[model samples]
Structure formats: structure tokens, C-alpha cells
Target: MQEIKATMAGSVWKILFKEGEQVGANEDVVILESMKMEIPIATEKAGTVKEIKVAEGDFVNEGDVIVVVA
Candidate 1:
């Protein structure tokens, strides 16, 4: 299993992948907004999306889990 974590503190702007969806390595799955900038979060491992831990507009701190892949 692999955990996709936020690289910076920000509000979740969008979720691009759904649970049970297959994702490739380095695919962007979530977009976050902070300091008027958009940050895209990508998975480091190829796998199915098992869970999404954050929702759109949700605030997350750096290192917070955003999604899980397994």
C-alpha cells in the first residue's frame, strides 16, 4: 500500500481520482490551493485507489494523508 500525502498546507481544490480507480505511478490525483498557487499531488506507486482521506475545500497540513493506494 502507498499513501499520498500533502506536500504543503493547503485547501483541497479538487479530487481527480475515485476510489477503486486504477492509477499509474506519478499520476496527479489531487489538486490543492495555497498562497494563491495550485499544487498538484501525485501518487508514487501504481495501484488502485483504496481511499480518499480528504475532500474538496478541506484544509490539510503538510504531510497529511490525502489518498491511499493499494
Candidate 2:
């Protein structure tokens, strides 16, 4: 399993995919809201989304695991 982490402190803005969904390398999975900016988070490797660790509107700190891929 691989964890996808938040790059910065922020609230989860949106989730583009769901658990068990297929994802491609560098595909945008989540968008975060920080400092009024939208930051799109992508998977580093292609895999199935095993779980979403965070939900939309939830706050997360930098390096917090947001999703699990496998």
C-alpha cells in the first residue's frame, strides 16, 4: 500500500475519485483549500484507491495521509 499525503496545511476541498476507483500516475485525486488557494493533489503512482483517509471540509496538516493506493 502507498499513502498519498497532503502537501500543505489545508482543508480538503473536493474528492474527485472514490475508494476502489482506478487512478493513473499523477492523476488529480483531491483538491485542497489553503490560504484561499486550491491545490490539487495527485497520486504518485497508478493504482486502485484503497481508502480515503480524509473527507471534504476536513482540515489536514502537511504530510498527513489523505488516501491509500494499492
CA lDDT, every prediction?
0.97, 0.96
The TM-score values for the models, in the order shown, are 0.98, 0.97
Clashing pairs in 1: none
Q: Per-residue lDDT for 1-70 in model 2, tens only?
A: 7899999999999999999999999999999999999999999999999999998999999999999999
lDDT of 1: 0.97
Alpha-carbon deviation at 51 in model 1, angstroms? 0.5
Error of 2 at 23 (Å): 0.2
Single out the weakest 10-residue window by summed lDDT for candidate 1: 38-47
